[model samples]
Target: MTAGIGHPMETQGSGAPGAGGGAIGLDELDLSIVHALQIQPRAPWTLVGSVLEIDPVTAARRWARLRDVGAAWVDGYLSPAQEDMTWAQLEIAVNGARLMDVVRTLCDDAGVLSLKQTSGSRDLVALVQARDVDTLAEYVSERVCRVPGVQGARVHVITATPFEGSQWRLRSLDAGQRERLRQFDETRPAPGTPVTAEPLRPVERRIAVALGTDGRMPLAALAREVDASVATTRRALGRLLNSGRLALRCNLARPLTGWPVSAMYFASVPAEHLDATATALRTLPELRFCTMTAGPHNLFLDVWLRTLHDVHALEAHISRELGHLRLRVEERAVILRTFKHVGRVLDRHGHSVRSVPINTWK
Candidate 1:
């Protein structure tokens, strides 16, 4: 999950409401709409309207406004198949003079999933993905380590991802609204199942590319883009989604939600207790990302909190509850700014301004 560190009302252009400003205030209805999508990203506008007690057209219009201003967006990408994919985190200590340049170059690389300028011993922290362990090793040893900044790097290969961004929710809606949205939700595949590494057909690739830009695109529009009949397109989409190959996510500007602080923790946990520890961590509402990695620090967590002070409270709580897990905290870093999140290019305020589709095969 990505969070911004900007003020709620900050803006760049005219001060007019809904204009291109640094911050956009969201009303109760707007928040409900976002929450509805968060629960079921591709839910029909009519269904969303019913859940939020608004007209279907009004619901669509409101979402259009948010999407046009870059306050919210929906993205679809190929999910990592356990048998064929690998995820890793990199901590790079770059030369001071070339930090910005190096960051820009890494952000433009398709393999780098998220890049952030952080406050800690390291200058930058990156989440990257590869086809396999060997590919990840070569990418780190050759491509990333050989960057012009001329700095040493530390790599942590993720071995098991117990929880990730897709499982995160804004939790702003009421219980009734959430229950209404859940009817359209799809069940996520269990971890460790081997998904067939099938190559996408040309038409399927085209559809995926289109959805990458707007996961909530209308079915008719998607069919037109792929030059296929609506029924055929819908069937293909269902197959892709059910095949455990594609994932849809609804992302919103962090400033709008009032939870702006983002923090990452690196710690070590015994192998035997990793599963229980990870499962417990996933129960926290603030937990955004959690994984077991192959490194000195075996566990990593990314969380979003209401304020910086809450970080201490959270750490203390974790220590008290799961102390028996023998989690050894190694390093902690606050994400000062995020340049890219998932597959979308974000602005300083964490709004998705543009999308650079993540095609792992490319």
Candidate 2:
């Protein structure tokens, strides 16, 4: 959940170190810890230690070190599927010289959840969310388009996201270890849950925001964040989670993983075939996020590959396999850098360093 919008896939391809700062390499233990969280973001250290063959205290200390350096973290998302809201992706062309300045300013807004510099006709791509269609339209017109360095923007409103970031995982752990942590899997809303209308409860919204900062925060700390009693906080949290009002997932610095390359593809599919195509696309392990969007291109796909060459290889496989729909890829581009992801400000290498509170619920 880029604070406000739909969840973009968090895949970075393998490559050399990035510029802007030195890279922090992760050893076998760090990778194992990340894989543990990918399976269950809220798992207890004892469980993780048992799975990885380490003392619980040592496991906690190593994770803390990774968290401190922005190498890994867990965050919360407000489910777009369950919430009545507008989700859109923005392609903004900015004044070249002031690109960094413009991104810094936009990062302060909760509505712009994910921002990326790309290698294509558009300089920036953003995932945005708002309370309703009118609010989204107004914000794009008055707030986003009018930003000092913005030249123009094209909006692609998201219709349905069948697959997203939280579903992706690291493959470091063996099957035996993964099965041990699989018992805690309850990350998504149960099927057929009703959509929630606007105007979330005050304390519930506060709890969601606090999770965006630290997904593993204790119940007592959450109560403090919202100034409510621990029992009250626990009850609200249970309701939010059980009802699918809130979403949580573990995230790590993508660049540090073996896959560091990121790419985006925009394509068109017949309205009737959209659902079938997305269902077929979900099985692709490289898929980061896939959505049926309301725009010239009905399909938007983001993925990470092992190498830059794999970009075209995956695209070719899609066109060849789904040719019955005459699915044409209108445009494709790779990400140059990500300035902000969801609510976290990232370094060029995609590590979270600072967080701007996600204010979408307000």
How do the residues 100-147 of candidate 2 rate in per-residue lDDT, one tens digit apiece? 889988888888878999998999999988888889899899999988
Best-fitting candidate, measured by lDDT? 2
Listed in order, each prediction's TM-score against the native is: 0.86, 0.89
The parts of candidate 2 lying over 4 Å away from their true place are 1-23, 185-199
**lDDT tens digits, residue span 165-243, model 1:** 7767765677988988987743334556444557666677677767878998888999998899988787677767767
| Global lDDT scores for all candidate models | 0.77, 0.80
RMSD of each: 5.3, 5.2
What TM-score should be assigned to candidate 2?
A: 0.89
Error of 1 at 139 (Å): 2.3
TM-score of decoy 1: 0.86
Error of 2 at 269 (Å): 0.8
